[model samples]
Target: MFSIVEAIRQRATPQAVALVQKDRTLSYESLFQQCDALAAMIQQHVPHDPARVDRLRIGVHFPSSLDYVPLALATLAAGACFVPIPDELADEEKRDLATRTGMDAVLVLETLAGWLPEGTQKLGAFSVAEQKVLIQRLPAVTPGFPAAAFEGINPAFIRFSSGTTGKSKGVLLSHESLLERITAANEGLRIGPGDRVLWVLPMAHHFAVSIVLYLYHGATTIIEETHMGEDLLRAGAEQKATVMYGSPVHYRQLVEAPPVGEWTTLRLAVATAAALDAATAEKFRARFGRDLVQGLGIIELGLPVLNLTGAQEAPEAIGLPLSAYECLLKDDTGREPPAGEPGEICLRGKGMFDAYLDPWMPRAEALDAEGWFTTGDLGRRDAAGRVTICGRKKTLINVGGMKVFPEEVERVLDSHPKVQRSLVEARLHPLYGEVPIVRYIASPEGAPTTMELRNHCRAHLAGYKIPLLFSAVPQLPLTASGKLKRA
Candidate 1:
């Protein structure tokens, strides 16, 4: 029942830098004031009755910035559930998501005019809106639309799953669950008031766990405009950043950038969103004089597993499960597998999600009878209890930290008039750990060119979801049951 708002309200270090953008710095006192103002305004739009406050579902759509920090805190401070919507999503997708999630309204930027569907009513473009927060209502609610089940749990946040197989569902988390995960994760991160985190991850995708951990622990968060190597290095040096969390793509850019000044302030660098190859790790170590820590982050679970010690030598190993968490590798029969034997990764920890937002799909289904959540990733445990991820039960391709599902891409490719059948698989990339390479069988009369297929995919899918290479095959490999055989 305890929310993070209480922690923000008790700002022990009032004058300390809480949030930092390129040239702007917001002190803890200022952040607290802004959150209070925003929360007060938000409360005006909701039912005055305190009992009805927690039922409001508000969507936050924006890029990462200093301003976004308070808006998110304010949403929770108002006793409402915050749903993060990525900025790059197509408008059609946004409308559909709003409908599926039964969102009451979306808080967007003023520049993003015409975001809602035609004829949708525009409400409070609040005069007190500091971060350009505009709320827009949907046209009409569907009859008997199921409301999210938050009967016993205090739902605080909802985020979309990676949608590796098909449509993405909402993963719901409560304040207590989030607080538990962040507290558990920080046993390894060790962030505090003296530490400054150089943040480059998008707010929509990662803010809940990472940024909240930094703020909750009284760490300064530094945000830069661009992820370019020069800018990142400059910001780290200027801001005295002690910790940095980014993707492989961001690290690759830093590794390729010319050596600026020695990064003496940086103590820990965490790599998430993709696999870290030996070459990239070596180059980063040579450049920064520090090993890149690989982390396993899931929406349902908080940061439970991280590679802290093995990053320098065995970068492939995902290290041991962090403190306050339990992990298991089980075989098909649900028995613990032998050491070094590959099995599905299962976890038992404090920060488990509250529920899936899809009203029909209960949260109980995701957890086993014994309360362990089976992460679909296949891995092996060593004698030291270290984990090495071998493959995934789900075929979600990590294209430079963006999750791209082959089924989603194949659906677009199969819809092409000149395409008969299609298959999508991961191809190794030096920079991006893996990219989707597509193989398709075209119609006999006129085979579509690779460019044509790429264009077709681009129209329907996100840019990262577009296939890097395309091949026209006489026929696609099929299994005995006639399903497309994936390598």
Candidate 2:
């Protein structure tokens, strides 16, 4: 299979603007040239034999910056696997990932020196020194998993799950999978050369489908470094961005008061990484006159479902499966659920993930005989065929055999003007198997009292589904992808 860099290069023109960050601009031609240069630099440090099965793996430990894009592309272009080590990770977490991936080297800038965990040597080069980047060598360790088998797939990227509800596993993707998913996703997004996408999500979490897709389709990407409402609005307006790809948190903050001025250029806004509450959708529609198209974007499957058909009418739904994918709501017996009933969401499509890295499970083992991958999400489809996510299957609360989807309860609590966000977890109980307890972050105006929250839930939720306790916390934890962490 050909490299992703080759696909991007075929569509690039010397004068075409590919990326914009603040005042800096990178032309498409220059981007490809820089990638090749960096790839050569990395190869000098970690040489390769084209015939070898176990290829080099390089971890990129950079922040969300312009340089990050080129660095990742370079790794893939060099015929090595690209792994992202999120900067938000603690030192121990960082060290654990390095060990788990069996990465030969980590690329870091000199500005962030002396921060990495021990057992790294300097593998410096003149070209890398010019950019203040260091190739930190890691101790060689024999991988417990099948490294040769993993490398046989022409792997391009490896990113770990957030471990939000369970133990995290490294998700692996090959160059071919990336290309296929981008093709499938664009059949819905319809992103073209004229489109300018405004991006605020971290590059580490979003690059596989987002940045790579835009570049492959010859679309310009305007990077908004700051998520501040005013800053985002200013950048979107100044850059004349036509599309916005961000998380639900970014959309919610933009709808808040103090009125960040308008950017009339936006025609489409996609909210992912978390559930988009109905309240935020209505407010965003009123303020921006554009629907917040909620989509289900999993690492395993790129963009299988999008709210293109019912964004305005059924804002809570994640729309239908894309043309290239088939989504199923299967009960425990692996049959379709009763009409209007919820079940575990399963998908059959092209571009599914290749393997689980740490445990070394192949895609053939991950999928069933029918080629369906069971997503842990519990979802229901309406008469219109639009699917709405109920909650995680593992996160469903069992209160004396009564089912409680935490998302259902949290949706009611989030509608309160005085609450920012909340988490509902199962707690032990004498009469019931477990009861839901809420830990929340209150708005600046102060939390509505316990009675107020309970009354609100009572109005919207079933009596059994209402949380038993409400405790305010300074903040809730978020995964590297900017979604709430259930674990």
Which predicted model would earn the best TM-score?
A: 2
Worst 10 residues of 1 by lDDT: 143-152
Q: Which residue pairs collide, candidate 2?
A: none
lDDT for position 372 in model 2: 92
| Candidate 2 Cα outliers beyond 4 Å, as residue runs | 49-52, 113-115, 125-131, 257-262, 442-448, 473-482
Clashes (backbone N, CA, C under 3 Å), per candidate, total 0, 0
RMSD of 2: 2.2
- For all predicted structures, in order, the TM-scores are 0.80, 0.94
After TM-score superposition, what is the CA distance of residue 45 in candidate 1 from its true location, in Å?
3.2
Minimum summed lDDT over a 10-residue window in model 2 is located at 124-133
Identify the runs in model 1 with alpha carbons over 4 angstroms from their true place: 48-54, 126-132, 140-148, 360-362, 396-487
